[model samples]
Target: MEINIFEIAKSSPSGSAAVTFMSYTMMENLLKPDFFNTSNDTIKTMMSTVISATLPKTNYTKLTKPVNFTLKHIREFDHSGSLSCVYWNISEWIVDGCAVLETNSSYTVCSCVHLSTFALIMQTRGPQKSDPPLELLNLVCVIVGLVFFTLALLTFALCQWSPGVNNVARINICISLLLAHLLLLLTQKFLNLIRPQQVLCAVISGLLHFLFLSGFVWMFIEAVLLFICVKNLSQISSKKREVLSSGFLCVIGYVVALVVVCVSVGLVPEGYGSEHCWIKIDQGFIWSFLGPVCVILAVSSEYKHFHMGC
Candidate 1:
């Protein structure tokens, strides 16, 4: 058998020689065409030449088609054969085109284009199943928290019997804590129903942190006041002094909480949870909350011992 490889050069001067040889080999295997026929050789040679000429240098390009077929049967093709042919042509085109682009460039373009196209395709497609919608969960939590808070508030308000100064301070602190939790829960519920507005989320998160910290500080103050009252039972009897002390402590708490929360959010805006943003405890958990709690407990214990001794 004799082959005129020079004919491929005449037909496809720009073609990759290697590609032409590979295609010819493939065609030979499939057709087993008789090389004795000049016409058959010429046809095979031309087809191989054309394919080589079109072959790309780099094997990278974005695939524009969706992974799944989104088009309706009627819209896609009038006949089944036509649809099959179209899909085959599309596949070949993607394979050839992808060979030309740089790998990284192709990947980035493919990802971005696919994402954009997928969004459009999804619009035409139906709603997808998501884990029991967040709205439902948030709604349940908000309702429950609100109900609990309302009942708690009413109970606190309706109780007319005056409590001791320390007890009154503790009640106020509890009320603040409950209110903070309620606000945090309500904000979270709203966030679930709607896409978060960054500014609003930040403000609400900051407020939540402030309130929570303030509540903690108030609790600490109540502990301190109780300790002082027990230790100096005779000297700390003035109602005005007691009220002034509580007020002063509250002011200090607010200031301290504001400073801490501001620093935290400023440094890392989303460091904490979405529901109740605060300084992340894990990083410096001991100093943030545990240290203060320990100090308060120690003070209270010492005061109790001193009083017992007296």
Candidate 2:
């Protein structure tokens, strides 16, 4: 599309030479307009470089040029206008950046500064529609998961405190599971709101990593205890059970998980905060969590089979 832009007044010393605003009327086939913003520094710098390379270096000069840009992740947008302003839904929208040229006229070209989803906002020439239903469904599911996890934690707490309950290892397992689920659920629910805060996101990701690893380690401890109980059913007694107290179980389960999480973080700090509040799938860091869980499941399955044979 050909963009016709005007020059700004030279009297404005605060304006940079490279910054230029383009206002153009859309052709019959062009998409609608919207503003773009992002939190990615690399994308922001890239957009600035692209604009500088495309435009003439002179200040306050009106020049028309053919510019083409390919922006990644441009299918996401937030609607903020009435039906009279915006009408069409974007399908595979991907543009670098856009802004309102004038409220009355559909024109404004802005620089892009972040790696974000590109979206197209079209004017209301036709019917205006609302957002899709899938977003609502995701929110509902997260809320439901939060409620159920809360109940599970409460039930486990009561179980731990009940009379004749001597196995602290099982209680520790439940504690780790509940904490992991609670943190994960909270992160999922509020991630979008706090996404701009890189430090907060990194912290959340680290906590999630630690909590989940703890859960898995506790599960392994529970499996070991179960196997021991099943194998030594005849030798069980109050005096012998002193070796397997709650203190011993808690130390083993918590310490192992802590070590794994600390070592993982020390080796690859950046792996915690790039995407959703989870470890980056790149490298083999993900296996730190997956490997232990797989081994625990395998041992548990073998124990189950052995118990069934007896």
Candidate 3:
């Protein structure tokens, strides 16, 4: 498919001569089309291959004039349902920066101000299901866990410890996990309200991403400390302990996670929020959270095993 990017040369300030416009079609199986309540009204859908248009640089997203695309219909046509031009927002198809210019049985023309994976979908109403008892069970479990986390944190804070005991990592891990779980629970509980406010939903997701990852970082920190303490107490002298101060631990715990979330946002801002107000699974943005978690799990497990062996 050809795109009408009239000012692409202007969009790219490199002033270098450009020769080609990049475009690709993705297989339908690449994305899951499970529309999870992205609409209370009729939802439009069409089984079509995903299309991405790109220039030399990323600034093609915002333009002086919108880009026009002639998306040929690849699905069987139904006259009864209406179709709309949409771009995948990682979680679902949305028409935020797109509009349908023209359509027919065989093709539809779409005009979008920003560039993204664009497609056409037909409008159809569908039934929804709710299991209140199951939701109540989930809520109860989260609340119980939160209560225990709070109690543990308080115990760490109020109780006196032996002179050599270090609770820095434990305390921070508790805080991070507690906040992360609390934010996630609240996000799900009031998702209906949060979903409509896209900015808030994105912010909540980013915070959850950072908080949860920070908790994992702290867990890794605690595991390393345990390993070090057990493996060789003599290696970490009082001077070395002074170097590995609480402040240094806190930096490693929270800053590392903050940097990750920031970089993820820089790479793909839309990856943060979705219909459910979490990381989007379509663009593999979920890996921003999962990648670190998996690494921490492997490294932490190794540390624990070594500590046990020692």
List the candidates ranked by lDDT, beginning with the highest. 3, 2, 1
Candidate 3: tens digits of C-alpha lDDT, residues 77-160: 554356777777867767787888888778888898866676677775543466899989989999998999999899987775
lDDT of each: 0.43, 0.52, 0.76
Model 1 per-residue lDDT tens digits across residues 1-310: 0123244334444532222112223432332222212221121111111111122342322223322212122121111011110111311212211211111211111111111111000001122345566757866876777677667667656675545544445556667677777776666546554223545655765677677677776666766676666565555566546554656766776787787776776666544443223334545632443554466567767866787697
Question: In model 2, which regions exceed 4 Å deviation?
Answer: 1-139, 159-167, 232-241, 301-310
Pick the lDDT winner: 3
Order of the predicted models by TM-score, top scorer first:
3, 2, 1
Task: Assess the local accuracy of residue 224 in candidate 1 as a C-alpha lDDT between 0 and 100.
Answer: 65
**Candidate 3 off by > 4 Å:** 1-42, 45-128, 304-310
Error of 3 at 25 (Å): 31
User: lDDT of candidate 1 vs native?
Assistant: 0.43
lDDT of 2 at 253: 80
Candidate 2 — what's its lDDT?
0.52
Summarize candidate 2's per-residue lDDT along 1-310 as a digit string, tens digits.
2333333323324443444333222321343232223232212111111112223454444434322232222222212121111112244233433332222123223333322222224321222243568657766776676577667656766656534444556556666666766777677668777555767887887787777778777777777666766566545535445766777777878887788778877887666764566776767778867876787688888978887898
Better of 1 and 3 by lDDT: 3
